[model samples]
Target: MSARFGRLRRVLAVLLTAVACQSPPAVRAAAPPGPAARASGVVTWAASADRMGEGTAGQGYRLVVHTSVGGSDLRVRFTNAFGDRPLTLDGVYAGLRARGAALRPGSNRPLTFGGARTVTVPAGAVAWSDPLPGRIPAGTDLVVSLHTPDAAGPATGHWMAMQTSYTGRGGHTAEESGANWTQTTGSWWYIDSVAVRPSRAARGAVVALGDSITDGWHSTTDLDRRWPDYLARRLHAAGAPVQGVADEGISGNQVLADGAGQAALHRLDRDVLSQPGVRTVFLFEGVNDIKAHTGVTAAELVDGYREIARRAHAAGVCVVAATVAPFKGWPEWDPAAEAVRQEVNRFLRGSPDFDAVTDFDRVLRSPYDPERILPFFDGGDHLHPDDKGMQAMADAVDLDSLDCAR
Candidate 1:
């Protein structure tokens, strides 16, 4: 019996030794709930993607975007909305911009999807990166690096990004220095929305939806000088409840036509309603539609405005309409177009279709000639505003008007 007991003890000892010698089981803390699970963040930055443009095979894009409403848990949304084939992004990194293509060394961090290093976005679908753990400041120049091994068949992207972004070819350049990013492009690919977890004090965000003026066409490139940019600064300075500002303007965009990108009426749902935490929609389009000589009537434009307001209100977003700015000196200007512009402005100012109205016409038109853009404000073309004009337009906004309860 003693010998049998000794053998049993030896066996138990050997088992214990084996277990002790083996590697310990990995201990993983429970993952916090996703951002969608928590209702704390708002979209700080966004650009409207009109359609799928041409894309390079096995290329990388280092997109630079501006942010509003500082907060933690930065998240990015990539769109393959118009793609005909699957878009596979093998590497994606978000970092603070040190300059043009360079990033602030320690700021660059990898983003994951379901704990995966790579994410394949299906055609006509959007993908949100897992929340990155850290705080991002307001008005930050965020640089997002993305590389895809197989990107073909109408790549999804924004065509006219006023700011310059970098591009590269071959391997995963997302993790390397910007030195490999040799090519320069003035467009943003894949990336559409960037959201951040804001403090409870934040009210919500507002999207500025318009045309070239709203897209910052004449404003200095690489400089956040758009009226929306200026408005963001004003909101921050005033400590307004509405902190986040999304510029959803597309160059040459019209409210009634689909010529220069999708019309505002057609793209409203994607550009304005689908945005996260959007409390208000700042409507400042229609100039292009009127100027295009498409015979779009004032009543038709008014109806379009009403439809936009109806849709926005249904989505619990307030609508603030701006009267079209003066453009008498623009080559497209004619007596008929001028009549339409005036009639439209009259309806926009007096109509109850909008929650509130900002008379951008009053702010931008010359006192001497109500139909003409103020000489100082015009960016040589009389259609788009210069930097000073952009600032003035932003200054004209009533910060209180942006804060909506819903």
Candidate 2:
């Protein structure tokens, strides 16, 4: 027993020393690819023209995105995803907003782009800020003060999946964008998420391109319930890590380039390959493509999925392919579609376009009916999963599979 114990202690000592000597992943300061034409996020809030009294100058909205850590030049996107007409020109500001933990208002600072203080965002368009001298510390709340010219009516924000939180100037007041019973869904407006890149060591973003599932629908709002959040949570938990997950999963987006949104292939480089720290792409798209294009055969969808994998892989990003979950008797589900899904799924099971496979479909779909989904896991719509189901899907991914690429 003494001999065995001594050997074990030596092994443990060596392991501890190795861990102590380890360093954070190398983060090179390099300019990465992004949207060529230029696009950004907008503040889409349900604007009540009634709210516009004599006090209109301060009535408009401002948006801010928070970074994982603070310090460095960062880029921003302002979008108006829920407007009927062109959202007029207005001013935007990015600055530090105090968390309840902070004590004073003197900490706020205005963000500027290219020496300009204002921008005009066309309807359904996004305006991105040129890299600014914004210093974002980790876990710090970012206050995006949007000085609207007037009331910007009912606005929706992207990257605010599963609900998000906001703190007023005083910091005591708190509100969530996903509140069920609000006078107006004013909360959803005002801002999109903020992403940060280290000007010194950061490479770029690892754009997590996918559908609603990847967008983290049904995950607890304000609590950060998206699977990407789960994935991000995992990354942070890692003793020392590399890269970050920049979620670009637009809800209702599709492949083959159609009405839902830019198709997967159409926006592959834009959404996935364009992000910073994007040495990898974890793709879980295509259920919508199959359902929305039922008449389309499995072979075609399989071909498209392979193309997505190939494109990302070509860009030096290790691709991770996720299986599409089952959908039996839903609004979008059709027998023919199910057949096609099955065929495509089979091909994805052992394909090489992907560096690895994250079987989100296999883990959640019911055993009794491969086509029909399990009742417990299905959201009432039968298409999307409930929060629990979403978590299960996220949990199904194998973190080890991504290590080689990292």
Candidate 3:
């Protein structure tokens, strides 16, 4: 028994040392600083988390995400929220994408956590990298390369990214040229959020929470034609106060159920509320639940919206609800479903629970058939909007509505 205890003590000591050595620099920097502290900025890009189908043990992923707001001192957030074991990321790099998997020369820079090159996020936890010194422009394609030496169990990532990313194997390729990243993928893995210290003139952020439409399903791949993307561009062009845009949409997701991903209600805290400098929550989901015909009534759906608004208001964030768009020709469309959509839109437009309302139904519906989508806007399948339709949706948004006092 004495011998066994001694061995256990030695193992424990070694593990403790390893963890101490791997502590991120941010952990140490948390100490009270002198009076000249820098002001923090809001999250400029984010994607809702969906189940990671499978995780590779010795692989790397180089994800390309477009920024919605430009700022300096960029930082990235990684999640292992669904993994069952600690996920170790040994190498991570951030750079501006030139094309394909290639990054602009001299733009790629190594990222460290707590001053260490490696970080091990425990199951169901998230870690934010220490801010990298540099300026990332709005609308720029930022490529994040990460290599995980040991990863398994369920991974946490955003599927149906719409944009193309690359993956590689063998040793860490985070700093190398894109030549080695031959495999292409349409999903963004591990990394979920990116933030920066914006200029004083820039305001906070708005998060778009919804299903497939908000997820940019029918929009052209790699084009960033999603409605939220369009909205971001508009904000930048107009110099709107709300400059940051986080699209927290998941394809096939619902407002009240976990079928496609964690329901909006379940993920609201992580995907919407927790983000820094988030001033408004744009709720634009519910078609899936109504069409699924799971007996979810209009009243029940309204209850979900009310709950979202209540939570957002409690957190001092404004709520902007969008009416569900017309979907007459969708396979699941029926009289009952149409009735629910209409009723929900009516409630959304009239509800005092929301700080503002955007009538997407009025914008996308055909005049001839109120329940049907306009032919010009339909992305075939009569559900999601095409690139033009996406632009229209963004145009319908009143930029001023997004700038709430909170």
Each model's lDDT: 0.81, 0.53, 0.84
- Name model 1 segments beyond 4 Å from true: 1-40, 174-176
Weakest ten-residue segment in model 3 by summed lDDT: 25-34
lDDT of 1 by residue, 69-138 (tens): 8889888888877777788997889999887688887998898987898999876677788899999999
Give the distance in Å from residue 118's predicted Cα in candidate 3 to where it truly belongs: 0.4
**Tens-digit per-residue lDDT, 1-406, candidate 2:** 2557534543553354233223211211112224563422211111100001121223433333334433355556555434434444344545554442231255444445556766655544455666655455654456555544543444434422333333232111222221321121113353333545553333333456777666655444445556665665554455223335566675555666443434677656545554444556677777877887546677778888888877777767777788888878877687778877877788889887778888777877788886766778876667677777866776776665654453
Best-fitting candidate, scored by lDDT: 3
Better candidate by TM-score, 1 or 3? 3
Q: Which stretches of candidate 2 lie over 4 Å from their true place?
A: 1-59, 64-71, 79-91, 95-107, 120-141, 148-193, 198-204, 403-406
The candidates, ranked best first by TM-score, are 3, 1, 2
Sorted on lDDT, best first, the list reads 3, 1, 2
Pick the winner on TM-score between candidates 1 and 2.
Answer: 1
